[model samples]
Target: METLTNLESFVRSAESGSFSAAARRLALTPAAVSRNVAMLERNLGVRLFQRSTRKLTLTEAGESFLAAVGGNLESLQNAIAAVSADDGQPAGVLKISVAPSFGIGYLLPLLPEFLQRYPRVRPEWHFENRTVDLIAEGYDAAIGGGFELASGVVARTLAPLHVIAFASPAYLARHTLPADPSGLIDLDCIVMRSLSSGRIRTWNMRNAQGDEVIATMRETVVVNDPTAVREAARLGLGVAMLAVPDVLPELESGELVRVLPRWWADAGALSLYYPSRQLMPGKTRSFIDFVVEAFQREDYARRFAGSLG
Candidate 1:
């Protein structure tokens, strides 16, 4: 008979996406997790993962195994939790999804502190701009900023960020700043295609007085990463809309200058979202608390209204 420990470790490795992360969650050595997985593979007589330096992707066998056993293990863990709520500290793998740009700019830097504080809580962070399927993909929680969400999930606000339009000082020095967004059509625009929307975004800028300008960007330098877009804008490529947190350093240093002082775009708020559950797991609750406390710090999310190109 297969041991529950073996099944537990296998499921954790699959959810965490690597042996090292799984081991961290289990408070075991990476080699130990590797051994557990290896033993299971040997017993089953098939390969489970196709691993590489770049990524750890699941094989068909691994996917099938995860699908078959993940929910059962989750149920078992939950039942144990309900019976022994106060018996122990929270422990388990926390799989979180975040956008690549925001993770790079803000969240990733704070992770070390979180790990140091919660020794029993191991986090497997996935930085991808793609939409997260909480149930299907086995993610415990997701940190995202968008106006919309899929059906049946619960979203909680993390922070509200304003949309600012900006461009580099170098670009403005060579090319006159567009006094109004209507002039943006004549200037270079850095186009970012949304992973979720599957369409190019051209936002309308509106002033506090209710005046509006629809900035239709026809000729744009394109990039997928928001960091790349910010870099391009910093290097004088074009004007771009960005979250205030991402461009704060530039704004403070005067490296990037805002356009159209009075008008601001309606950028959506940032949030942490997950699939609704009748019983939130201890791991999930701890993860949410850590994130909420981090971003709720007043200085962490403060941003001004202006042009960010």
Candidate 2:
């Protein structure tokens, strides 16, 4: 029987495609992971990885071995952990990925309460805009919109990711308010560039009658981050289309006012995604329950509906 540590290192290294990346996820050094793999290979009398200066590729034996062991590794670990845990308490590092603006504006405030409730579970969160490979990166969960679902992953809708147009009072004072989406072409619109596509994102707006129109605007300032676009609008730079949740504080506090109240961009839902394991980790299950309950208690879905009342 192989040592559990050696098996874990092999599985992670194969999934991540590099010892360094596996090291980061496993909380070990690259050299340590490499040595573990080497020892495992020597014991088995077969080379597991085709090593090169730039990359590591799995050999035929490695691929077959991974096919047999990779799927069961997490379950085995979780089972052992469950047995060892005190009274089934959720105890482990719960790693998650989230967008920066949403994580800071919404999720960060809820962490204190979550921590207080589950003291044994430590949260490791990454605030980024890019979609992450959950299984390969060993993330427990991710929260965002429009992520392409990987195999063995499932999602639960948290709230609708609605976007609406807003501008500072001073900006509207300087420029004429557009009567409809078509009139937006004449104003200086602060737009965000798509991180994945590397193109200036076009505005998708819908009327009360559910008629959709793609609006093109004259760009005054182009930013990559959603928070930056909100700040630009707040500084009276130009009108901007931003997520309702992101600018909720500013909108409520009178720092920004609605431009076209009837029109909004229905992108998708903000969702919590995780691997579809038969036996989920206690920490992950608890977090899902906590977040769902919190959303219900706060009525976040209705509050973030992107409607001007």
Candidate 3:
């Protein structure tokens, strides 16, 4: 019988398309992964991969082998983990990626409760604005708005990421508030430069009357992050377009007030994404359920919908 470690190395290398990538996911050296796969091929007496400098392509035998074992590898690992643990408790590191603003303003508050309930689970989270490769990078999950769906991953919507214009009371007191999207052309607007596109984003806004307009504001301050834009607006720098979830506390505390209240930009849905598998890790499953329950309990979808009063 082939050793489980060798089988794991072979399967991961095949799935990731390169031994180096598989090594990263498995926390092993590239040489070690390659050796294990080489040993496996020697034992089986069949060449599984067509090796090339650019990419690793699976041979017919390798494809057949993967089809036979790939579907069951996760189940086998979960079974081993359950039998090895003391009580099958959800105990492990849960790595996640989230946007800085949402992570600080919303998810941070719920961490204490999650930790209290699952004492054995530790969270390793990254606050980033860009989308990450969940499987390649070995992330358990991620939270963000409008990420493209990757293979073997699924997303669950938590809330609508709606953005509206906001300005500090002091700034509005001195400058005239915009009555509509067109009026924004005369105001000093704080805008965010898209990191992926390398361009200043244009605002696509809609009113209650179903009229939509694409407005380009006079940029006074250009930033790369939403948090910086919110801070600039709060400092009375200029008007900013921000998500309701990011500015909810400031809006409630009277630090910032809504401008052009009738109009908001429909960005997309904020979602929690994870690898779609038949047998998920205990820690990952627990975190997913806990977060979903938390969102439902808070009624976050409607509360942060960015609708005007």
**Each candidate: how many clashes?**
8, 0, 0
* Candidate 3 residue lDDT tens string, 1-309: 898888899899998899999987765689999999999999999999999989999999999999998877888887866543436578877889999999988898999999998898988888999998888877889999877888999999999988889999999999887677889889898999999998998878998888898766888999999999999999999899888998988988999999988889998999999988656777888889998999999989887888654
What lDDT does the true structure give each of the candidates? 0.75, 0.89, 0.87
Say which prediction, candidate 2 or candidate 3, comes out ahead on TM-score: 2
Q: Model 3: what TM-score?
A: 0.84
TM-score of 1: 0.71
Order of the predicted models by lDDT, top scorer first: 2, 3, 1
Error of 3 at 20 (Å): 3.5
Off by over 4 Å in 3: 1-6, 27-71, 78-88
Cα error, residue 245 of model 3, in Å, equals 1.6
lDDT of 2 by residue, 1-309 (tens): 999899999999998899999987776789999999999999999999999999999999999999999978978887866663436588778899999999998888999999999999999989999999887777889999888898989999999888899999999998888878888899999999999999997778998787787777888899999999999999999889988888989988999999988899888998999988766778888889989999999898988888543
- Candidate 3 overall Cα lDDT vs. reference? 0.87
Q: After the best TM-score superposition of candidate 2, give how far the Cα of residue 123 lies from its true spot, in angstroms.
A: 1.6
**Which candidate model has the greater TM-score, 1 or 2?**
2
In terms of TM-score, which candidate is strongest? 2
